[model samples]
Target: MIEVLVVVGPGLVADAGLLEEIAAREFAAAGVSGTLVRARDAAHVLSLLSPSSPEGVGCAVVLPGRSAEVRSLIGRDLGAVVWVDVERADGVTAAAGATHLHGRGIGGLAWGIRHAVHRVRHPSRRIAYGPLPEQWGELYLPGADELYLSDADGPPVVMLIHGGYWRSIWAADIMGPLCADLAGRGLAVWNLEYRRPDLHGWDATTADVAAGLAALATAHGSDALPSGADGAAAPDLTRVAVVGHSAGAQLALRAVADAVAGEAAAADGAQAAEEDARAAAGEAPAVDGVRVAVSLAGVLDLVEGDRRWVGTGAVGAALGGRAPEGQAAPPYGDASPLLRLPLRARQLVVQGAADDLDLVDFGRRYARAAERAGDEVTYLEMPGDHFDVINPATPIWQATAQAITQALAAGPTSRG
Candidate 1:
């Protein structure tokens, strides 16, 4: 029996009563009992989780702003923390080891509680690939027998890259539902939280994605992702898919291209030597190991996006300047997924016909360009919006999921 604790922040007392009601309903639905505690600050919450406290809290549902307060208790056998309404500084809270739920407002509490229960039952791990606070990913593993979506080797691994037009305010939490859904379907889910371009420079964002995928490739036998629960086999990294939504599609496609290029360079000793020299000069290495890349209503063309002032100029802001005129140059040349075609890896490009005209246009063009460049591409353009593709319950996402499953089943094709 797990004892859940719902902690309300002092500043959020107005919603305390509603929080209690929702907690009760959620607890009942989860078949768990909980205690709602009104705390003044982090110190008060800490005192409640202390050994001297009467209530044994196995899973905690914490409010925003105070999530960092319980950071010290993480990985200390204190229990899992589900931080709700996360934003901005919440990235640190997530890095501190709490499962964060953002942007859903009061509705996020429902998912937060669900996440806490999953953590207590399945026991996911948040492993950091880099020393920075934002360079970490949470691995969610499903029961072995529950793998309805698995192949002969094992469950396919899917790394989710969330997108908020590459803004810092949009962390990995937005991908929570999708992560949970994929895991429930028996796919190992890696929900990554990276340093966004807004606060940590564009290069940092791209570097973190590459490094995160590299970590996933070796996660099977490493401490980064252990066989969960009953020692179920780790996910088959050899058959991996990178799924990105909205702006994340850009990162996903770019990473695939970089990896393919990296592999080719590695095979050529002279090219590898040059790349090593470039690495010594501080250029980060490209990462490999992804078999398929899925883009959901992705902002795939940086030049077009910047030209359209999409996301109110989010593309330029993320790439650090307007699209280079005459010829693609600098950030746009390397950062734009459309500019880096023939990604080599199989691609599933999904776009909503009703999404922003720019995104739909970009998806259509990118898919055509990729196919022209001799890459395997499946273009699925349906009726939906930007976010409909992310919602698991939506028809758009169901079709996208089926496409991803098919792509992963096909396995990796030789780039040569």
Candidate 2:
């Protein structure tokens, strides 16, 4: 009998036990079955896999969105691990690392049902922008719009990062109408879809965010994609800002902070000699490009949100219960925009007082903290609900547009 370790990252956790039952069948069919243990994050799974032995577990079944982490596992039985992926059907396919688990047995079947319902309820014609199948963004609008920026080589791209509390259950596809609105208004839009915490965790989600942004940046510079299929304009990443809602707001802020942290450190080396020494020491110059964050009712202060809503456990789910240590690198500190302050670019936070009380507090508190940290922070408190801010038909979206316009006018800066 083979011991099967069903590593339930963030994705399978969303399946609500359906995938567990399916996995049992898969293992039974393969004549490998003993104990079906459930593991949370990769760290926990690795710990249980036996520190003394490399191939401890008979076989490990990793769920979706964990391809990156699973690929990174060290000293594991390469041939015994199976990655759970979903394409057309649910069956175990061949993969370079371990084994590939594919087919409808995937939790995507459940997602398909819900996604279908959502697609119907929220009608949108936004396209998915990606060369890879997993990496897709809801097309709000492409590079060129009916009306380009009044002053620029081309319209700036407004990458839309939707918020579902960083959960896989909440997809970027739900932000269709909002993307359409932005694209319709002469803005290039890329509604990014990332692997939520379900399959892997925050690490995967954050990595996807970086990859999606890079893909767009590459696409912008590539001559291959001159225009959209409809012959619309191509996005210009040289002048780009992120318009993120709720949890996505926090991510956008973090990206800006991470991208500019090096520059901020270099700025401390005020003396030319020190700067020259650092450069001689193989230090890179601060990246200069279009950078700004437009947050819509975002949960910027995760530390505060976790404390207030301790019962709900939303923050724990996003950060894997890794509490902030006042000053640390990842798992928590990197996740919190409040801690990653002193950003070089401007941040326009359009918060709604009528939203969740914790989220509201996050917006207000984050704005104050940003100001204290010398970031160009603009906090706007409007009379709207959480989701209302993303609606183009509403006045709140107009405020978002205004913020974007200002950021575009200000243009790019090398303050990082």
Candidate 3:
């Protein structure tokens, strides 16, 4: 028994009875039985939408009269009841001799409701594969990060880090589709959620990731293993490959650099100072003994980022406000994968040609830098925007999937 509630705006109050009659007919046509509730204003609309109602509608159709009010109501009841906004026509004709709804009307309103309903019922599908048992937990791991685990028995375990300029608003759920894809390919996937720089700052997020990886390795009995290709013999840690999107790519690169720097510092008895410096800089020391790192539209060059318009907001947001004027370029330059290239592990960078945010130049620059540093870097450019790379329906996403699958199948290789 699907139920829908239509909230008419004040402007339509004069013809409220007529509009309600039209909506009732439309609902019957859509195979949904519902009642049209006329509200005096946006406030009255909210009152009707409160959780106290017993009918508990499955969806709500709102005309665009009070858009802000509609949005607020939807925000409060998301996942509980679907919301759709209707556009009205102002009597403007298009080439087809039909009036278009730019701003009052039943046609646009009905269309929006139907579209929303379809989306709610038919979300993207994901398949899970591998032998690892599913595990779920929330822990205050390294850098005081919140971690959620989904484990399976597979040859290689993949870690997915979402990109949001390292902002807190983004979560592991953003990578859900991607993780599902990797898992379906018979790989154990870990979807990691870390503290955003906005909440705990950059260092904390990095610490959380480092800790989470360490926890993952320890749980799988791979912590004591030696470094190198042969290290794949260790328990569930056969081969560690990280897939990071956007700023997550920056985090992944920093993780690798910190690993190398940690070893160097430890060997020279400079570990404490190094740790202090890392803390001050809002960065983690890095994960030790990773085999491969794949970055998707990674923002490697902060200086380049500043020069360009794409990711400046993200960088500024993550860095706790714009870098001070003439402050030696804020650690973003040093942290960029381009500057740290000649990376120890084999690297693959996949970028979208239509990605307006990161742009193609960033990936090209990183590739050039890697080659100059004698690092083995494979760059794959495909058509589509930033989000399309993870969207299964897009060809670019399929290409990325193939690249990852091939890399995993080939195992780790030496660039030198």
Quick one: best TM-score, which candidate?
1
Regions of model 1 farther than 4 Å from truth: 1-5, 13-37, 40-44, 47-58, 64-78, 84-96, 99-122, 148-152, 218-221, 228-231, 274-288
Q: Model 3 over residues 245-341: C-alpha lDDT tens digits?
A: 8888878776766565576787689888887986786544444446678888788776566556455477766765554455335466456667676
Worst 10 residues of 1 by lDDT: 86-95
Error of 3 at 71 (Å): 16
Each prediction's TM-score against the native? Answer: 0.82, 0.63, 0.58
Which residue ranges in model 2 land beyond 4 Å of their true spot? 1-133, 139-145, 150-152, 228-233, 262-288, 322-329, 414-416
TM-score of 1: 0.82
Q: Model 1 clash pairs?
A: none
**lDDT (tens digit, per residue) of candidate 2 on 181-287:** 66667776777877777556777677667656655655555552355435655556677887788888888877766656644555687447645853574332322
Q: Rate residue 163 of model 1 by lDDT.
A: 95
User: Relative to the unseen true structure, what is the C-alpha lDDT of residue 255 in candidate 1, on a scale of 0 to 100?
Assistant: 81
Ranking by TM-score: 1, 2, 3
List the lowest-lDDT window of 10 residues for candidate 2.
88-97
| lDDT tens readout by residue for model 1, 345-384 | 8899999999998898899999999999998889998889
